[model samples]
Every structure is written in C-alpha cells, then in structure tokens.
Target: MAQAPDHAPDHSGEALVIQKVQPFGEGQIVLTTPSLDADGRLEDRHSAYHENRSPPLVWTPVEHVAAYAIVVEDPDAPREHPFVHWLIWNIPGEATSLPEGLPNEASLGLIGGATQGVNGAGKIGWFGPRPPPGHGLHRYHFQIFALAERLTFGPNVPLETLVSALKGDTLAEGLLVATYEAPESQ
Candidate 1:
C-alpha cells in the first residue's frame, strides 16, 4: 500500500498552533471519521461515493479571543489558489469543540451564532474531498482563527471578503491537515 506523506507544512510565523483535545490529543487536529485513516486518506464513504458529511473537530481556544472562525481548503487543488471546502465564522470564543455532522445550512443554531459561507464550489457548508481521479493526493487544511472582535458579516459571505475582514484582527489561529485522493477508476 502507498503511504500518505506528511503534507502539512510548517506555519511558523503568523499561523497559530491549535491544541487538539479529542479523538487524538495535542498535535494536528484529529478529524474523526471511519471514512479516513490515521494518515488522513479519505475513504469512499466520506467522498462523493457516499454521504459527504463534515468531520468532527475539537480544539482549545487561545485566551482573550472574542470570536473564532474556520476555513477548510485544498491547497493542492489544480487552481490558481487553494480550493476552499468550508468556511464558517462568528464562533463564540467560549466554544472549544465542534460536534460531528454539522448541518449543511446557513445558520448553525447549535454552534453559538455561527454561520456558514460559500465554499470553492460556490456552495454553502462542508464539501467533502472529491479530487479528480489520478490527481495523486491532496492536502485539506482546516484552519481556525481566533479573532479579537466579533465580525459583522452575515451568512454566505464570500471567502475573499471574509479573509479580508480578518486582516489585522486575528489574535491567534490553529491548523489541522487531512489528505485524500480519488480512486483511479472513478
């Protein structure tokens, strides 16, 4: 079997280090899904072949943060920039964990006034890995930003706008990486 490489890059300067607390502990964020293996390869179940649900995530927030945001992207996608898979913001600073199977809706009532934004595919909510066949492995980065203030944007905001709004306002951030490749025959 081909082993998945450690595709997670070093975010030394500006990126904040996330402290994972569940599923796995105190390292890269653990994406708990029977659909993926220890090395972050996505199984058929978590891909387009089956139910494409968001993976459960848990982490510790930095002190004094007023709000949090999450952005999941595929940096290896064949595009000019990384392909966004999920974008959510306005997570209450008090929240330390996100439950599995988050609903594919605009407003997440259960997550402390959190809202979903459009992904790279121009859709809302979590879009699971669906890399083209024979494209080798793709790294999916799940990044969380700790902001010093609550954002004013509404749901379905564009990725660029959200990113721009975060500038100079981020207190800290964390990252978790996962990898996936499409079946050769698919």
Candidate 2:
C-alpha cells in the first residue's frame, strides 16, 4: 500500500504551535459562513456555478518564521490522491490574514509579497470547492506552514516541489477545515 503524499511525518512533535483560525471567531479551526455553511453545503455564489470567491483566512502569527505557505486540499475527492485547491507561498512572516475573494492571479499585490500556484483544476490562485455533483460532503483542509527560511522559488511551482522543499524547514504549522457538498440536482 502506498503512503499518502500529503501526510508528512509528524516529527516536530508538538513543538509547533497552531493557533485557532480567525474567521470562525474563537476556539475554532473549522470555519463556516453562509457561503460555506455548517451543513456542508457551499453557496452557489462561492462555487463554479457562480462567482467562486475565495474565503477569507486569518491565524495567529508564529515566532521567528521567515515566510509562510498555505495548502488547501480535499482529501475526500474520489481519486487516487487528494485534490489541491490552492497553493500559496512566500507570504511575509509578519502577515496573518488573507482577505476574502482574492483575484485569480499569480501575484497578490495587496498581500505582502505573496504569490499563488496552480490549483488542481490547473488554474492559478484559488479554485473554490466544486466537488462533483452528488459526490457527498468533502472536507477542505487548509494548512499553513511557518518556515524557518524564506522560500526562493519563483511563482507557480508544483505543490510537490513546495512540500519537498519544506521538509526539515518547517518551524510551525496550522490547520483549518471547511466542508462542501455539491447540490444533488447538478
């Protein structure tokens, strides 16, 4: 049996501190909005059916991090492996939040020196959750990594490249989860 590529070995052993995700208010890593409801149904406006806006994200900063990376994936996708929805890197260490609805572009000018990579759909930046219709509820995992060194890679690198580079260099990490289910009708 093949080991999961997304499951990095937990070597850091509780040394890394992951703070609560801010969008859900307090004491929560799993978040929800009317657009991304608690019932695991995403609003059409936040899906491919409509506007497809990226949800806002915020977290407490870690100490001594030189840069940060975010990876969003759906482990429940009916495939050989999890599906990547977003890959963002080179976020300035001082940064702590991503505003809602970032443009589908490579460079996010408003966010300090941040850049986006290709998503599972092969599009740049965020590709909001749009699981196959009636595929049931899929959990979207939003993982943030604090790196000891700033990444020197250019834009649009594959997620594997980023993950490979992160080995042994992760200073801290955080996680947030949201769920979405495609409407049965379509």
Candidate 3:
C-alpha cells in the first residue's frame, strides 16, 4: 500500500498500516471526492472537530466486480499505525459513488446493503479526522478496494480482521487523498 502513486507525494508520514497491506491485483479505479477543496484539503464540516460528517465519494465504475470497500486512514497520526477514520464495505459493485452524510450505523441498508466496520475510535461508520491540536497536518487516504467476492463476515467487522481477509485478495483499488489539521488554538 505504500507504493506511492504519481498523484500525491506528501503522505504526512508513511503510516504503518499503509506499509503493511500489499497492493491490489492489477488496474486502478479513479477515485475522486468533491468534499475537498481545490487544494485537496478536507473541509471543516467533514472533520471530527466540526460537523463530523462523511464526505461524498465518486469513482470510475467497473463491471463484473463482486463488491467494493472504502478504508480511510490518517498516516500522519502519532500512532502505531495509520489511524482509520472510516471502514465501510459490501458496497455494490455497480455503484460508482456514495452520497454525502451517511449515517453512523453498522449496517447501511440504504446504500446497497453496505456494512460499516468499527473505526479507529471504536465507533461504527465514518469518524471524521480529529488530528491532535497543533499536530500540523495529517493526510487521510481514502482507499477503495475492489473485491473479487463479498466478504464472508457479518456486520461490525474489525480492522485487523478486514486487513487479514483482504490480504492479496483485492482485485483492484482506487484512492483519493486529502489532508486535515486541527486548529492550533483549539
């Protein structure tokens, strides 16, 4: 996962989680988000320090794929590994984008039966960035992994389990990179 693309260079820090996971099979889906500013900085509302909302994401749609998973992590956090901000999976392969403001629930029945896993905060669904105050900036890697089949597990999956399950099973991946920083005065 640490295989840097030609797109983004500065990843805050080389997150341990990113350093572990292997790159997907082959090919890549173009991941894009409108929630970020032109400079690729995450918006205030999409932050845990503010509105704490999940950002909307769009990607290049594919055919014959089983499903897709979205994993968002902050590599710059002072942690053992990258801090996971969101863990959502089972998105229908036919889908090309996710709508904004997804509710913080385990099973997302609204969006093609997608289920959310526990985030780094131990909360279900998307946990917006809350990098430490005066921590400078943290790059959040919004990675979408294309699976060859649906995961065998049920709702509320754990991070480690997901990582283990996806080991070399990713058919492809799409990434959207954005950065966030807590206000120094906050």
Candidate 4:
C-alpha cells in the first residue's frame, strides 16, 4: 500500500494576523458585523434582522495574557450586542479565535466552561438577529479581549456587570463582523 503524505496540506488560504495595535479601551477598540464598513458606519439592508447578528471583532494581543474574554453586541438596537447577545470568557492564552456560530449553546465544545451573560431579553445565552422589519441593517460587533487572568462573571451577570468587572484589567482586544439579511428581505 502507498504511504500517506507525512506533512498535511496547507489549506489555510489566508492566515489570521495582527494587522495593527489599538489601546484597550471602550472607544479605542470596537467590533462590527458585516453590515458596516471599517469606519463603523451602518450598511444597507433596511432591517436590523438582516444584520447577520454576528459582529466581527478586532484587537491587539496582550503582552502577558493569562486568559481572554469575548462579548458580542449590537449597540444600535436599543438593546445590548443590542444588550449582550453572547458573553464568553476564560479562553486560553494560546487561542486566537472566535469563529462563527461559536459560543453557541447548541453546538458542543464551543464554550465548555465559559460564562454566558444575560442578554437584553433576560436570557442567559445567544440571541440571534431579530431586527424589526424595515429597520435598516443594524451593526453587530463581536468583541474579543485578551485578559490578565481567567474571570468568573458569576452565574448570570449581565453585559454591563461583566464590563464593570473587566474595568482597568483589559490587556488586548479584537472583533469579527458578519452580516445577515432576513429571508423575506433577502
């Protein structure tokens, strides 16, 4: 029988890299879904539901990170991701990812022991895009942060509470944005 190739193929078309650095602050770093441009401006779609709901996050890697945290949000919706669609933390230091459909409770191994913060609706999990009809595509941002240590946001801390806990302690941050239009609108 023929022996298999010793080295695996390189399927990674374009590897992820640290493009630049930004101060780890509320206004310094930001995340946005596919609906917006690099400038953080809104895009067309005429419905927040088309917002894809998953925001693209971008941030600098911490110099000495013991752990990391991620928070996906949608600020324009008068709500938290409008108000915390997803909250995940305690990621390891070697990790540099927050792929799509992640922190998803339905999907196994996405967030084994990570904390899930409460959303605007008072739920303790992810809440996908449900933007109102004709309400232009709202921006959703998936914010990732490099922390100095592993955190315990408690059993069900809201986004604000978690943010408060992270005060004066962020080391690095990033974001990944994705856009989605509702079926009828699409």
Ranking by lDDT: 3, 1, 2, 4
TM-score of each: 0.77, 0.77, 0.86, 0.59
lDDT of each: 0.70, 0.70, 0.81, 0.52
Q: Write the per-residue lDDT of candidate 3 for residues 1-186, one digit (tens) a residue.
A: 587455533334444443456655666789998888988999999998889999999999766678888889888777645788998888988899999999999888898889888888988888999988876878898988888788867656667788877765677777788998896768
Writing each residue's lDDT as its tens digit, candidate 1 over 3-49 gives 85456332212221122211111223233334458787766555654
Q: What residue runs in model 3 are displaced by over 4 Å at the alpha carbon?
A: 1-24
User: In the order shown, what is each candidate's alpha-carbon RMSD?
Assistant: 8.7, 7.6, 6.6, 17.7
- Candidate 2 Cα outliers beyond 4 Å, as residue runs: 1-36, 39-44
Give the C-alpha miss distance for residue 93 in model 4, angstroms.
1.7
